[model samples]
Target: MDAAVLITIVVMTALAFDFTNGFHDTANAMATSIATGALRPRAAVALSAVLNLLGAFLSVEVAKTISGGIVDESQISPAVIFGGLAGAILWNLLTWYVGLPSSSSHALFGGLIGAAWISFGADSVHLTKIVEKILLPALAAPLIAGLVGFIATWITYRITRGVPDRLVTKGFRFGQIASASLVSLAHGTNDAQKTMGVITLTLISAGHLSPGSGPPVWVIVSAGTAIALGTYLGGWRITHTLGKGLTKLEAPQGFAAQTSAATVILTSSHLGFALSTTHVCSGGIIGAGLGGRERDVRWSVARRMAVAWVLTVPAAAVVGAIAGKAASLGTGGVIGVAVVGIAVAVGIYLASRRTPVGPAHVVDELYTPAEPTPARKVA
Candidate 1:
C-alpha cells in the first residue's frame, strides 16, 4: 500500500478501537444508574454519550503522554500501529461478547508494545515510561479508587442507617444522576484521548507531523465523534455484568461509586496518567456492593472479571505480535491482516444476534440476581 493509504488505514483502525472503548466502558458511567432506576437504560446511555463528547475537550494532558511517552514512534512503522490497533479491537470485542469488564486501555498498550517489540525489538519499548505511566497506574489507580469507594460506601450506610428509607433512596437516586454524568465526562477526558494519541503518533511516525505534536483538530473531532456514537450504541453485556451481576445496586451505593470513580479518573487524567477508567469504575462498583449490608456480592462473577483483567494485556499482545509479523511481510500482508480482523469482528456480531442484549432486557435480566441455592434437605 502507498504510505498515505497505510496511514489512513491505521488511523481508521485507531478510531474503531476508540469506538470499542466507548461502548465497552459505557457501563462505567451508566451501569449503576440504570440498575437503580435513576436513569432509564436508553436515557442513561444517551446522556453518557453526550457527556463523553463534551469531556473530550477537557484536557490534552493524557493525549500528550500517549503520543510521546509510551513508545519510540520513530522506531516503528504505520503497519506496526495498525497491528496494535487490530489486537486491541479484537480483545475489546471478545471481552464484550463474554460480558467481561476488561481494560481496553491495557489492551491498547499491550497491542502497541507487542507490535513494536516484534518490529523493532525490545529497545523500541520504553520500559521506564511504561512503568511510570501505564503499569503503575494499572496497579495503583484501581486500588485507590476501591479504597475510596469502600470508605464512601461504609460511611453512606452508617450515616443513613436510621434515616427514613424513602428519603434516603430518593436523595441518592437524585445524586446518582449528577455523579454518573460526571463519570461519563471523566471517561471521555481519559479514554477518548487514547485514540487521539494513537492517531497523533501515527501521523508523527508517518512524518505527517513532527514528533510530540498534539492531535490535529480533525483528529480530535473524529475521535470524539466516534466514541460518542459508540457510547450511544451501548455495550449491554458488560452493562448487565456491572450493574446487576456483581451486586444489587441501590441509589446510594451507585451514587458513591460514580463519585469515587470520577474523582480518581479525572485526577489521573490531569496528572497525565493513562489509567484504565474501566478498572477504577469496576472496583468502585464492587465496593458499592460490599457497602450494602444486605446485598450479596457475587464473588464468582467478580473473579471472572478479574481473570479477564489479568489476561487482557498478554492476550492482546499475542494477537498484536501475530498481526505485526504478517504486516511486516508487505502491504499485501497488512491487507490480509485487516481482512481477518473484519472477518472475526463480523463473526462476533453475527453470533451476538442470536441472543442479543438490549435496553429492553437490560433491567430484567441483569438486576434480577440468581435465586439462592435451595436449602439443604436433611440427609
Candidate 2:
C-alpha cells in the first residue's frame, strides 16, 4: 500500500530477474570454452562470474536508455514495473527449461512495454525509441555477429592449415581462455545494465529519484552481485544446447565464436544499444559451426531456436499485459501475481529435475557428436 514498500518490493524483483538473466545467458560466454575443454565446467563458470561482476561497472549508458528512453516513467507506477518483471521471469524460466537460448533482453523490453502500455496507453511508451534502439538492434545484432564469426572461423582454419592437429587445438584452446573471458565481461556490460535500468526506473516512478538520473552506487553493486552469483550457478541446459546440441565445435572455432561475440557486445554497449548477448553468441556459435570445412551445423536445432526467438516478444508481452492489468487493481492484485509466479516457478523447477542436464552431462556431450551425420548437410 505504501510507496516505499512497493518500491522495495519491485527493486527486489528486479534483482531476481537479473539473477535469472545471469544464468540464462551464461551460455553466451562460457559454453564454447567448456565444450572445447579450454576450461573445466566449474572453473569456466567461476571465471565468467568474476568477469561479469567487473564488467557491470564498466558502463551505464545502456542503463540510461532503459530508465529514460524506452517508456514514460512519469505515466507509470512501480506496480506496472513489477508486472513486467513477473512476465519476464516467467518467460526466462520456461525457455531455460526447454534449453532455448532466447533473448532475455527482449523479454524484459516486451514485459516493460506491455505493462506500461496496459497501465496507461500508447502515450506511455516511446514507440520511436523502441524501434530505433531495441527492435532494430535485436534484428541486426545477431546477423552481424554471425557474419563476423563465420569469416573469422573460416580464416582461422585456413591460416592454421597443415599445422599439427594437436598443436592447433592446444594453441586455440589457450586463445579461448582470453576470448571467452572477454565475452563474459561484455555480457556483464550489456545485460547487467538492463536490470540496473529497471531498478532505476522503478525508483524514479516511486518518486525516489528524478527523471534521467543514473543508477546509484548501491543499485549497481547489488545488480552486479546478483548476476555474478547466478553466473556461478551455471545454466547448463542452455550451455549444453549451444556447446553440444548445435554442432561439434573445435577449439579454433570456439575461439573465433567467442571473439566475434565479444566484439559485437562491447561495441553495442558503448553505443548504448540494448542488445541481446544470447542472440549474438548463438549466432556466432551457429556461424562458426557452418564456417568450418566440416559444416557441422544442425538445421533442426537452429530452426527450433529461431521459433523461440520469434515468439519471445509477443508471448512475454501478452503475459505482461495480463499481469499489469491484475497489478493495477491494488495490493490484492500484487499478491495474486506473486502467488501465480511462485507456483509456476516451482512447477518448472520440479519438471526440470526429471531430465537433469548438469555440468557432467555437458562435459560428456562435448566429445560425443550426435548420431553419425554427414558434413555440410543438415542432420
Candidate 3:
C-alpha cells in the first residue's frame, strides 16, 4: 500500500475505534440516570452526545499522554497502530455483547502495548508511564469515586430525611439530569481524547507531524464527531448492565453516583490520567447502592464484572498481538486483517440481532422483577 493510503486506512480505523468507544462508554455517563427515570434513555444519550463533543475541546492533556507517553512512537508503524485499534474495537464489541462494562481505555492501552512489543521490543513500550498514568489511575479513580459517591449519597439522604418521599424522589431525579450531563462532559474530556492522541500519533509516524505535536484541529473535530455519533446510538446492553445489573438505584443514589463519577473523571482528565470512566461509574453505582441501607448490593453480579475488568488488558493484548503480527506481513496481510475484522464485526452484529437490546428494551430489565427461587422443602 502507498504510505498515504495506509495512513488513511489507519486513521479511519482509529475513528471506528473511537465510535465504538463512544457507545461502549455511554453507560458510564447516563446509565444510572436512565435507571432512576431521571431522563428518558433517548434524551439522556442525546444530551450526553452533545456534552461529549463539547468536552473534547476542553483539554488536550490526555491526548498528549496517548500521542507521546504510552509507547515509543518512533519505533512503531501505522500498521501496528491499526492492529492495536482492531484489538481494542473487537474487545469493546465482545464485552458489549456480554453486557460487561469493561474499560475501553485499558483495551486501547493493552492493544498498543501488545502491538509495540510484538513489532519492536519490550523497550518500545513505556513501563513507567503505563504504571503511573494508566494502571495506578485505573485502580484508584474508581475507589475514590466510589467513596465519594457513598458519602455523597449518605449526606443527600440525611439532608432530605424529613422531606416527603415523593418530593425527595422528584427533586433528586431533577438533580440527576445535571449530574449526568457533567459525567458525559467529563467522559468526552477523557475518552474522546484517546482517539485524538492515536490519530495524532499516526500522523507523526507517517511524517505528517513532528513528534510531541498535539492533535491538530482536524483530528479533534473528526474524533469528537465520531464519538458523539456513537454516543447517540447508545450502548443499551452495557447501559442495562451498569444501571440495573450492578445494583438497583434510587434517584438520590443515581444523583450521587453521577456527581461523584463526573468529579473524579474531570480531575483525572486535567491531570492527564487516562482513567476508565466505566470503572469510576461502576464503583459509584456500587457505592450508591451501599449508601442506601435498604438496597441490596448484588455481590455475585459485581464479582462477574470484576473478573471481566481483570481480564480486559491481557485478553485485548493477545488479540492485538496476533492482529499486529499479521498486519506486519505486507499489503496482502493488511487486506487479510481488515477482511477478518470486518467479518467478525458483522458476525457479532448479526448475532446481536437475534436478541436485540435497543432503547425500548434498555430499561425494561430495570423494571422487571426477577423470578424468585423455589422455596426449600422442610428437612
> Among all windows of ten consecutive residues in candidate 2, which has the lowest summed lDDT?
370-379
Candidate 1 colliding pairs: none
Q: Please provide, for model 3 over 85-132, each residue's C-alpha lDDT reduced to its tens digit, 9 standing for 90 to 100.
A: 988999999988877898887888788788888888888888898778
Residue-wise lDDT of candidate 1 within 1-379, one digit each (tens)? 5888888888989899999999998998899999988899989999999999988877765455453456676666777788788899999999998888888878887887888888888898888977776667777866888788878988998899899989998999899999899888877877788888888878988899997688888988888898998898889888988898888887889888888898888777677664678888988888778777765688999889878888887788889988988888888988899899999999998776656677755677433323332222100
lDDT of each: 0.83, 0.84, 0.83
Model 3: how far is 254 from its true place, Å? 0.5
Question: Which residue runs does candidate 3 get wrong by more than 4 Å?
Answer: 59-62, 210-214, 271-274, 365-379
Query: Under the 3 Å rule for N, CA and C atoms, how many clashes does model 1 have?
Result: 0
Best by lDDT: 2
TM-score of 3: 0.91
- Cα lDDT of model 2 by residue, 1-379, tens digit: 7777678878988898999999998898999999999999889999999999998999866445453457786666788788789888999999999888998878877787889889888888888877785667768877888899999999999999899999999999999999899988878877788889888878877778898888999999999999999898898889989999898899999999999998888787677664678888988998899897798998898899988888887777788888988888877887788889889989998877766677876777443333332232110
Worst 10 residues of 1 by lDDT: 370-379
Compare candidates 2 and 3 on lDDT and give the better one.
Answer: 2
Flag regions of model 2 displaced more than 4 Å.
60-62, 67-70, 126-130, 210-213, 271-274, 366-379
